[model samples]
Target: MILYIKYMVSLRCKMMVKEELKKLGLQFVVVDLGFVEILEDITPKQFEELRKNLAQSGLELLDDKKAILIQKIKNVIIELVHYTDEMPKVNYSDYISEKLNYDYTYLSNIFSEVKGITIQQFIINQKIERVKELLLYDELNLTEISYKLNYSSVAHLSNQFKKVTGLSPSFFKKLKEKRNRNLENI
Candidate 1:
């Protein structure tokens, strides 16, 4: 059986799920960002117990089909912004539509309706958050950060960063308490 989960965005989350499944005496064939596949079907009682354990850790077991679709979208965006080693050659709209097998217009409408923000806004937010991370690492300069994130220029990146965060990239980098929230929270 396949189970979709919320807030399963990090390696730590994956480990927690594995450990919990072990404690519950369930064997999972695979566990990925937002879903898990188990070798055996779980009974209602077992499912409830697993849900309770997951909830205690600030996670939720997704049962609704629409909710699962949303989670999948979140996972895809998270993977792109967080795990991808290089910028995509094509636009994110085309990439997302091809990857998810959904029309871009439909997906954009649903995402905006549910998220209270446009998908483009979400992408910008995520990209800004990533720039913050790269800045903190101190390994890449502003131009490199811009290039890595597919920004047209350093000035453009700085402008957008200021617009979203109310501070310029340099100012944000100098702050001692720079923080990057998880994609799900954003």
Candidate 2:
């Protein structure tokens, strides 16, 4: 039996779900980002108990088909942006459509209707967040970060970063440094 779950984005979330399944005495074949496959069918009582337990932890057992598809879309984007070592060379629309096995137009319409933001905007936001993380790490230079994130050029990356954050990348890094310095003095 396959069960879909909402808000199961991170590795920690997967672990929590696995633990919950174990506690419920349910054997799962796989506990993935947005779904789990169980070795045996779950009884109604077991399903209710599992749902209640997951709800307590801010996770949800999803049954709605549209909701499930939306969660799948989110999981794909999250995995691509936050988990992958390298971004794909193809256009994001193609990549997303290929990954989800659905027409891009259909997926885009559904995601926009449900999320209130276009997938492109979501991708940009996620990219900006990744940029912030890299900046905070103090390891990669602007050029390196741009290339790593598959930006066309440093200027493009900088423009998008400024547009999203209202602060230039260098200034953002400076703010982090200043905060760290102040913390050390305390």
Candidate 3:
């Protein structure tokens, strides 16, 4: 049985779900970002208990098709932005469409309606968050970060970084460094 889950967007979330299933003696064949596959059928009572447990852990079971599609969209973007170091060469819309086997227009419309944001905007937001994480790590310079994330140029990345965050990348990095030093002192 494959069950959809909302807000289960990280590997840690998957681990948590697995732990909960183990606690209940339920065998999960797969526990992914937005869904889970059980090794065998479960009783309705078991299902209800699992549902309540997941909800308490901040993941709600999804029954709506539109919501499930939106979760899939988010899961794909999250995987691309957070997991992959190098952005792919293909257009995001085409990649997403091919991956989901849906018309891009239909997917875009539903994503906007359900998420209150365009898919492009969501991509940008996730990219910016990824940039922040990379900056915090202090492992890669801005030029390398821009190239890894597939920006046209370092200037394009700086422009978008400033536009989204209202601060230059240099300043953001410095701020993180200062905050880390203060934590170390503490």
Candidate 4:
């Protein structure tokens, strides 16, 4: 059985889900960001118990089909932004459509309606966050970060970063205050 989980954004979330499943004596074939595949059919009692426990940790078991699809989309974007170090050569719309097996128009409309933000905006936001992360590491220069994020040039990246963050990349890098957006809000 496959189960969709809400708010499972980070790698820590995957580990927590695995640990929770083990504690509940449920055997899962795999536990991922938005879904888990279990070895056995779950009883209602087990489901309720697991659901309650997950709720305590700011996670919810998702049952709605639309919500599940949205979560899956979010999972893909999160994986791309946080895990992959390289920018995709293809357009994000086509990449997402191919990955999700849905029309790009439908996906974009649904995502915007549900999340109140365009997919492009979400990608840009994630890219900015990644730039911040890379900057904080202090190992890579602006040019390197731009290349890694697939920006056409450092100037383009700086412009977008400033537009979204209201600070130049260098200024933001030096401020030292941590700013992060909520995953669901993104």
lDDT of 3: 0.90
Which pairs clash in model 1?
none
lDDT of 1 by residue, 59-127 (tens): 999998778877888788888988898879899999888889999898888888777888788889989
Per-model TM-score versus the true fold? 0.91, 0.94, 0.94, 0.90
Evaluation by TM-score, superior candidate among 1 and 2: 2
Candidate 2: tens digits of C-alpha lDDT, residues 1-186: 999999998889899999999999999999999999999999999999999999999999998999999998888888888889899999999998999899999999999999999999999998999999999999999999998899999999999999999999999999999999999999
Ranking by lDDT: 2, 3, 4, 1
* Candidate lDDT (C-alpha), each: 0.89, 0.94, 0.90, 0.89
Candidate 2: lDDT of 141? Answer: 99
Best by TM-score: 2
What number of clashing residue pairs does each candidate have, in the order they appear?
0, 0, 0, 0
Model 2: colliding residue pairs: none
How would you encode candidate 3's per-residue C-alpha lDDT over 17-127 as one tens digit per residue? 999889889898889878899988878888888889999989998878999899999888888888886788999999899889999999999999988999999998888
Tens digit of lDDT per residue, candidate 4, span 92-117?
Answer: 99989999999999999998999999
Give the 10-residue window scoring lowest on summed lDDT in candidate 2: 74-83
What lDDT, from 0 to 1, does candidate 4 have? 0.89
Off by over 4 Å in 3: none
- Residue 143: error of model 3 in Å? 0.7
